[model samples]
Target: MNRVPVSSSNLSSVGYDESNQVLEIEFHGGRVYQYFDVPQRIHQELMNAGSHGKYFHRNIEDKYRYDQVK
Candidate 1:
């Protein structure tokens, strides 16, 4: 499977599946989540932040993590 690099402003860690275009995120407080079919708008939002790392830390870290999608 191909994998893409995803960075989120609200995430401490990021994972991706290029074949499926899925993105997985890990937050600060043991939160994990998977975002599927991520729209370009959201992708841009994640990438274009001035403080991308900080945005992720403030918004998602410790909040959620990636879960398998049906």
Candidate 2:
């Protein structure tokens, strides 16, 4: 997955795989996680949001199944 860097205190970048509904998020402390069963719209909204970290916590975090990548 190709992640795009974002400006966020808690988040670093994001990547999405639409075919498999996987959303990958990289955090500032080098922790990376992949969320499963994510909708493309949620990924789009997250990328477009002004506060990526806030959006992730409020919308994506704990909402989908995920695994730590790094």
Candidate 3:
């Protein structure tokens, strides 16, 4: 997946695989995680949110199955 760098204190970049419904997020601390079964709409909202980290915590964190990619 190709991740685009974002301006977030916690998140470094984000990527999505629509075909497989996977959402990938890389943190500033170099931790990378991929959330399974994520809808594209959620991905878009995260990208557009005022605070990506806050949005993740409120809406995405612990809400989906995930794996630590790195």
**After superposition on all CA atoms, what RMSD does each candidate show versus the true structure?**
5.9, 0.5, 0.5
Query: Over the stretch 5-59, how does candidate 3's per-residue lDDT look in tens digits?
Result: 9889999999999999999999998999999999999999999999999999998
TM-score of 2: 0.97
> Would you estimate the TM-scores of all the predictions?
0.47, 0.97, 0.97
Winner on TM-score between 1 and 2 is 2
- Which candidate leads in lDDT? 3
Between candidates 1 and 2, the one scoring higher on lDDT is: 2
Off by over 4 Å in 3: none
Cα lDDT of model 1 overall? 0.55
Query: For each candidate, what is the lDDT?
Result: 0.55, 0.95, 0.96
User: Where in model 2 is the C-alpha error above 4 Å?
Assistant: none
lDDT of each residue in 1-70, candidate 2, tens digit only: 9999999999999999999999999999899999999999999999999899999999999999999989
TM-score of candidate 3 versus the correct structure, residues matched by position: 0.97
